[model samples]
Target: MSHSPHNIRTASAEARGRGATAALLIAHCAGMLDLVALPVWVGAALIGSMGLAPAQAGLLVTLFLAGQVMASLVLAPRFGRWPAQRVIVGGFALATLAFASLFLVQTYVLMALLHALGGIGAGTALSCVHGLMGRSANPHRVFAMAGLALGLFGILVLGSGPVIVEKAGAATLFVLFALATFTAAVAALMWLGQSQSVAENQADSSAPTSTQLKAPIPKVVWMGMLGIGCMSLANAMLFSFVERIGMDRGYGLQTVTSILIGVGLFNLVPPVLAALLEKRLAAGRVLLAGPVCQLLLALAVTQVQSLWLFAFAAVVWVGVMIFTHTFLFGLIARLDTSGRALAATPAMLMIGSAIGPLLAGVLVDASGYQGLGLMVAMVAVLAFGCFLRLQWATDNRAAVVPRSSH
Candidate 1:
């Protein structure tokens, strides 16, 4: 009996369903630890009594993003031939160490170095996760799964991290995150394998680029990228600076955690809705829903004063973020008709991710938190335009649902 790659059983409902389950679970579990670790760490770093300055504390955030960028850009392409699961597993183990480094290292400089290393691992793992989501047979389901997992995991981390931080101290709190990372590593080992063949599936499955080359870059993709960047920037701003926001607003640490957790809970909705949809929609629409939600949340940020109101807003913001990113990533994955799509997406996303926090950081420094929040809303306008264009561009391609976006 010969197994032909073209005639793989992955298309069967049973196989595809199982694949989606595994993909979703693995992503959700790992995402919980890695995603929450940074901001929690940021809070710890900025507030720590080591007399570290904001810029110095900011190094941890910078290193994390920089490491993620390096991993996604410099390493992901290199790991093209390696099984995604393998990369993910190794990445998790590295992340565990990275998390541990902060606890064990005394100096900020050393902690930054450790964070960079961890970022390498975390970035690679995340890239592989994104790659896997892209490689799925049911693109919508896969993307939705990623979104759901992200929301669920965000809930876990944000909801849990602060309590743990308060009870166990920062280092011990990280130990718990480390355990989560390790659990994800084990799950990946059990469920994910090298033969997952993400590279092959995406390369072959993505939409064609022949006409794309002849035509201009549709401005839609650029717009989409910008929109995502701004939305994420705002999200990052909240994640990085929410502690200060709370302090300024006379909120407690528990309230801060509640706010973050609220975002996670609200984020939990879109993936479910996205997954339940009967008709397969264009990736752009799928992606657009998230940012649109984010824009709404961003606008409502100033209006919410109570813990409950803030929590509701946070939940919505996070949900929007999960769905939007999951949608865009899936789009990028499926866009590899000409094979350059994967390489291009990482750079675009990384720029967006890094720029978001940096912009927020600058705004906070110059004008304060309210100014930064306004800046986020301003960026969302740009994102909306981009999402609109991308969706409009897809109106002509009725078959866009069945294939990639290149």
Candidate 2:
């Protein structure tokens, strides 16, 4: 009944692979917590603690996002040359240090600078994780898992962040972020070595030559990146103001927070559903459904004043966004194969996010929330058009090959 040596080695390798995947997922979740949750959690703190206006408080978030975009754009393409594990560890260490230093700084400018530096660290960690995930055996599944982790983490942070801020002050949350990164760094240390093997093997067998690795990607991939950027832009615009929107509709703070938590909880559903359906359905069809649903839901949320109805729309909108993002990440991975596009995913998302609030604010000032919703819905429509064109291009190119073979 004893297993052979080869079987033992295979089993050990599989276990290590699972361990590595878990480590990456945890690290990714921790790295993204600030991106998804910090602005909402710290907005009031930033204003109250620093005596800044709401607009100025928002600027801190903008600086942080700008840092992320800058780092991801600059660092993602170097995954082939640099060791991902080292980058991840270094990024986490730097972020943890920055977060820990927040308590020592009092000025808005200094805090903004620290947040930006921390963002660079977080962005580096995220890009490395994305590169690793892109080159994984199952990028779609990894992304879905990562999305689920982030959603669950979002719920936990959203639920607890308010309490922590109220009782302990906003600065405590930064310490918590540092602890989370430290935990991720520990996890990374456990399994990141395994990731090196996976990366090396993928590089060796997939390309076999520098030319193939550096080959030109099609224009459709760039278009798809733009499309994703638009989607993120619209999403950030609405999401950044969602609580305010609810409060403006006469819901209390507690009610708005509850609604947001509900939305975050619902966010976990779509990625799981997408992962399950990915094998059974055409990815193109699934991809196309996401934005269409989002557009309808965006319009619905704006039109309805009922808290229950708006909550329902918000949940569904979040789910659709997650589904769309998972599919899009998969598409980019497939398109590039070199992981560069995958690395750019966070940058594209951050770029849209950075633009979203500005655009939404302008639209709201000119025409109110109704106008904002309409503008975002239009952006979604345009994004859907981009995806449709991508699908058509892919299908047409595929059709050409068989005819040429004949």
Candidate 3:
């Protein structure tokens, strides 16, 4: 798939615009960076590394995805008329408040409450940061930035957070995270300017200039959401529980953690490559891999129990997850040039994300890690079947469009 340099001119204009887009992503996601591993790292320190149960630790992510679902479903639309910056700032403010509570709150209930709030903040921030990416002169560059950020944070959390915990303790980490998120939120509003507001951005540039306006959803787009959802569900299940899976199998907790951290390095590779191939492969080509990867990885799980086997499975499996996510966003942005409807796509992805984790949790509670992995693998099979149906439908639709117009 031609995912990169779609129409790249070696000229400075493209390069300059890319620089500006990366700056915007960094500025907007600062809160994200500031608190990257704060919750888990801090929790590990305060709760005692052994004190943090796998399910409990997984809940932190689960709750966050739940908030993302609720926010995406409820809050996102109401703010459709606001600037993307408003959401960014509000998310940061909320995250800061949550972290501030962490500085003192010690009860599990209290931590859950704050984490739930932080998830909402994370959901809002992610949705908006992604929306901002839609405005880039080169959308792939923005995707690359996102991949870079996620990878960097993974490194910080998996690698550096442990060091910080060893030296400074959890409370100190909370205070630092609070400061950083607050700074990011402030910077987003100040630097992005007011013109980037959602209400002001209704001009439909993606449509033919002579084309009549209609509500933005095309059948193709909804189908795209399905694929995206499947990809994220796999990612959430794997990311939140992969360590649990490894540890249960006999690896040391520290070794499993290190393996998970090593994941960040690969996470960086896919988006850059996907962006390069995006133009060459239609968005569907990239998204179609979601189910394909899931199908193989699911069986792969049955075969491989060793640490190396899990690691090997992760490489392409993670790529499939990243492919679905990155391309889904790219496709949604293409379909809805108007900033408002486009905003919902992130929320949809989050919704899928929430479902995956909750299901994983339920399965784990019932059957343990191996069973949970198999259940997720089943879901992947179902999602792949859906992808095949959608692919056929899309081809049929493309075939009919010319005849219908004539």
Candidate 4:
């Protein structure tokens, strides 16, 4: 049977959309391995195999996050100029090599360098993914899908990672990361080329040129980035130390591990809920609530001595971050039509994450767990303030929500 020309075009577009979604999901799952499995990679493995002090381990992780922030800042502005497919494929391939190298390295300095290099590669790929998602019909929906994928990935790694690390050794975790990234790169090669074609076909005359892309990002976008970054800072500051806090309060290892596992399991729900409520809830209003909720949770986790209370707060913490950040991501996507600012998503996130552990350590040393809670409160206020400023920008311009079919 012969198909109509319009039907053929529709079918082809659907096929391309499906392909792009698959590529984004796979690449996001792989690129976010470090973050989703942070407790395993940073807390457990580094202390166990590398024999580093908690501070050293934290610093090492910080170095890796610093690399991500640095690479994102460099690449995101030029994202429009570069070929997205090549950048993503090359980035993951580089990360594959770096993660593999990590399995062989033992010295702290060598390990730190390898971690940084791996972070750079992973960050580059992740930035491009954000850029692509921003350019899609519904950035919020696409990002929510990615978040759901990451949550599932988190469950698998968090549930199994400790056992694997215990049995096979810390270095095996690096091998797992290498395999994940290698798979992502191979998958991108198979699928992301189609996404590139779709992007090119969708490009408009107003699409930013090299010269325009090089121009400074606008103030509103920067504000959104900073707001998101502040939320990340508070989340990471407390999250990095949650297990330690529980143990210090006399919670058993078994209980702490169970909380982490619970966190992984519960992580699945928030993104699904966010996706469902995308149009029902206003992103701007939700953005304002995110920081406040983060502060309250941080305080609960740190100040609560009861095992149940602490566990509940700790488990919900990262999930809230995921849910709230999804809206912020979509909002920023709308604010930046060129997709360049959204491309810097990694930088905004990692800058805060990079500072979080170091700052938490200092605060903990200076005062106590309460000190960390105080820091979260301060950061939360900053985040709320930034989001508040964004209300005027969004309210004044109704065009922020583009007229496109989701």
Whole-model lDDT per candidate: 0.61, 0.74, 0.59, 0.81
Give per-model TM-scores: 0.78, 0.89, 0.79, 0.91
Pairs of residues at least 3 apart in sequence or in different chains that clash in candidate 1: 227-383, 233-356, 262-315, 263-314, 263-315, 266-315, 267-319
Off by over 4 Å in 3: 1-20, 27-56, 75-80, 162-180, 197-214, 298-303, 315-317, 402-406
> Residue pairs in steric clash, candidate 2?
none
Separate clash counts for every candidate: 7, 0, 11, 0
lDDT tens string, model 3, 1-406?
Answer: 4534534433333454344354455543443342234224423453345366545655655666677667655544443345666777888789889878987887888887897897688567656665556644444556666766666655666565555665776666667667767776766766655555222223321222222123555666666667566666765665455545565677765765576466656667777777777778776666566777776775565446666777667545555666666766666565555444445545555565656555665667777767766766777776766666666776787787775552
**Among all candidates shown, the one with the greatest TM-score:** 4
Q: How much is 267 displaced in model 4, in angstroms?
A: 1.6
Q: Which ten residues in a row have the lowest lDDT in candidate 4?
A: 197-206
Ranking of all predicted structures according to TM-score, beginning with the best and ending with the worst = 4, 2, 3, 1
Candidate of highest lDDT: 4
What lDDT is reached at residue 188 by model 1? 77
Comparison by lDDT, 2 against 3, better one:
2
Name the runs in model 4 displaced over 4 angstroms.
1-9, 194-216, 397-406
lDDT of 4 by residue, 316-364 (tens): 8888889988988888876666788988989989999888877876687
